[model samples]
Target chain A: MLFVENRELVVPGRLLAEGDYFAGEGTFLEGGKIFSAVIGLAEIREKSISVISLQGRYIPRRGDRVIGIVTDTHPFGWILDLNSPYTGNLMVSELVGRKVDVFREDIGKFLRIGDAVLAEVREVDERWRVQLTASERGMGRIRGGRLVEISPAKVPRVIGRKGSMLKVLEETSGCRLEVGLNGRILIRGRDLKKVNAVVEAILLIEREAHLSGLTDRIKAKLEREG
Target chain B: MAEAKPEKLLVDGRRLDGRRPDELRPLRIKAGILKRADGSAYIELGKNKILAAVYGPKEMHPRHLQQADVAVLRCRYNMAPFSVEERKRPGPDRRSMEISKVIREALEPVLFLHLYPRAVIDVFIEILQADAGTRTAGITAASVALADAGVPMRDLVAGISVGKVDGTVVLDLMKEEDQWGEADMPVAVMPRRKCITLLQMDGNFTPQEFRQALDLAFKGVEQIYEAQKEALKEKYLPSLEEGR
Candidate 1:
């Protein structure tokens, strides 16, 4: 039995469904009933019931592309702050793409503290130890782009459905965007004016992500300002 | 100011505040009131104004304090120096410390702490103004703040204080009643399952009076739980409705 409609705003402990429903993220099952575990919009997809939370810190998951900042260096690896409660560790081999003897070479040559790197969450253990890899093309240390961070929960709105909002952002402003699920967006453009326009639009999106017609407003703003 | 106690707390079934024995104070709750905190709420029950903020599950500080298998829940219950009639000491005193511990325990059962291992969730409840029943109000506001923070929980907690004044069991005690009454019991409940989370009494109650007080507290909790849900919806639903 379904208790809440699709996309209905629900608070914690509101019953979402019952019987054969599989509980998904933001929901829990107890005594044959599925209930929302956070304040979010309930999503009923076929046999599964889940709630999409509107606010929260980003939790690292495998295969998520993220932007991390180097905060510490170790003999064999470096610790990268993922803008999350947990930090991601990038081994020297993962960044250099090959084994380099820690005793023979100073790993500091490849990366240093305060350097921003575009990396992928390669693995997250049961204990929440995150391992990141940056060896792939366009995945190493980020060099000349303006970074804007917003609430991680709003990253999906910036991406939009099937990357439509992203395409609008890029096409309207003429600025390339690298959006991290962790809420860090890197914008690069040859024209400073267009880059600033993109930054403003991103902030606007973050502020009004829950409103309708946001993508159109962003597009119109970028076209007028960029 | 020490004043003479009224000869009778109730006159013709009404208390000094012109309320019935079972009446509650006017309540107003607003969620997401603080912009900086991850989640926050401001609540006013009659003259008591309280603000509650939740700032985690973030990385726990002081490495040794991090629990290996679950996030640590910490609560701080503070009263502004001017919140009371007499100036309260600015910092955490013995009473506030005990309230803080009990508040944390009251809220811990609802949270899915194990989901955020090696982290800490901090709940800070500030009593901006006090009449009476601030601790129970704090628990009620803190639970809403936790939900506002998007912390996963099985249920939300609601609380109320019931007591006896003039040998009559009453619901939602006022400042005068709390100060001069024969018994005061603060009870917190997980309203969804009717589970009692925090129950404390600081005076005398007969066994029958205790049962009546418990029932009254549950009734108050039901009303508070509804208000809590409404507050959460009021903060997040307008945007959600427009988006759809």
Candidate 2:
């Protein structure tokens, strides 16, 4: 039995459901009962129950696209700060897509500290060591763009349902967006004003992600200002 | 102040504070009070004012302190120099150190620490004004702060100090009762499970009085549990309303 309506706010330990409910993010099951593990809105999708958390740091998972800042370099790879608890390790081979003799090539030529790169989380080991790969097209060092970061938990809302929000953002503003699951976004546009307007819209979304009719509001705002 | 104990602590079934044996002090809790903190809460219970802030699930510093399978939970309980009647020396004292350790233990069971290995979650509890029962109030606020930080936990912990004063079992002790009471017991409970995570005693209690005190503590904890949940909602409810 579901005890809460969809999008109803719940606090930790509040009983959410009972009997055959699959616990999703921000929720846990205990002895035939399901309870919320964080303060957020309870979401019920079919038979699965989850709470969309309003606040939290990003925890790296496989196949997630993230933006990372190169921080340190070692013999075989470089360490990238993923804006999370775990750092992402991108090998020289992973970035170059081929094995090269580290002794012969200066790895620093490809990427240096403070250079932001768009990459995919390839693997997260049992120890939470994150391995990143930027071999795909448009997934290398970021050269020029405006970077805006909000809470990682709100990233999904920015994307909206089935990329609808992202489409609205790009179509209306005439800008391109690369949204990282780790709460970092890159906006590139020929017109600086349109890009800044998109940035403002994104910030407004982050602040009001929990509200309904947000996508329409954002679309209207972008059409007006962009 | 070193004032002498009063001859009578209770008259007409009213303690010095004019509260009944089963009455609790006024408690107010606010969540997400600090702009910079990942999560923060301010709690005022009677004269006890405490602020708790939680930062992390971030990278743990000092490589050796990192846990292989679980995040390390660190707590610091500090009282402001002007918090008490006598000016307290700033920094960790023996009493505050002990309280910090106990508070960490009280909150540890509820957290899913294994979810974030090699990370550290720091809980800082500052006593801005204290009139006894500060440790219990601190625990109450710290739990809310942790939840506010979006840390996954099985439950929230609520705490209160109960004791025997003037040979009468009382719920929620004030400074005077704590100082002159026969037995003071601070108890923390995960109310959902009815499990005790922290239990400490100072002074003596008869078996009957201990059982009564424990019952009273649980009742007090239930009230605190409601307030904790209410505080968390209060922080987010405004946005929730505006969304509609």
Root-mean-square deviation per candidate:
1.5, 1.3
Q: Which pairs in model 1 have colliding backbones?
A: none
The TM-score measured for candidate 1 stands at: 0.97
The DockQ of predicted model 2 stands at: 0.80
Worst 10 residues of 1 chain A by lDDT: A203-212
Model 1's alpha-carbon lDDT is: 0.93
Candidate 2 stretches greater than 4 Å from native = none
- Winner by lDDT: 2
Model 1 Cα lDDT, one tens digit per residue, B1-244 = 5988999899999999899888889999999999899999999998999999999888888979999899999999999999989998899999999999999999999999999999899999999999999999999999999999989999999989999999999988989999999999999999999999999998999999999999889888888999999999999877777776
What is the DockQ for all candidates, taken in turn? Answer: 0.73, 0.80
Residue B151, candidate 2: alpha-carbon lDDT: 90
CA lDDT, candidate 2, residue B211: 97
**Candidate 1, CAPRI quality class derived from DockQ:** medium
Q: Locate the minimum summed-lDDT window of 10 residues in model 2 chain B.
A: B235-244
| Isolated chain A TM-score, each model | 0.95, 0.98
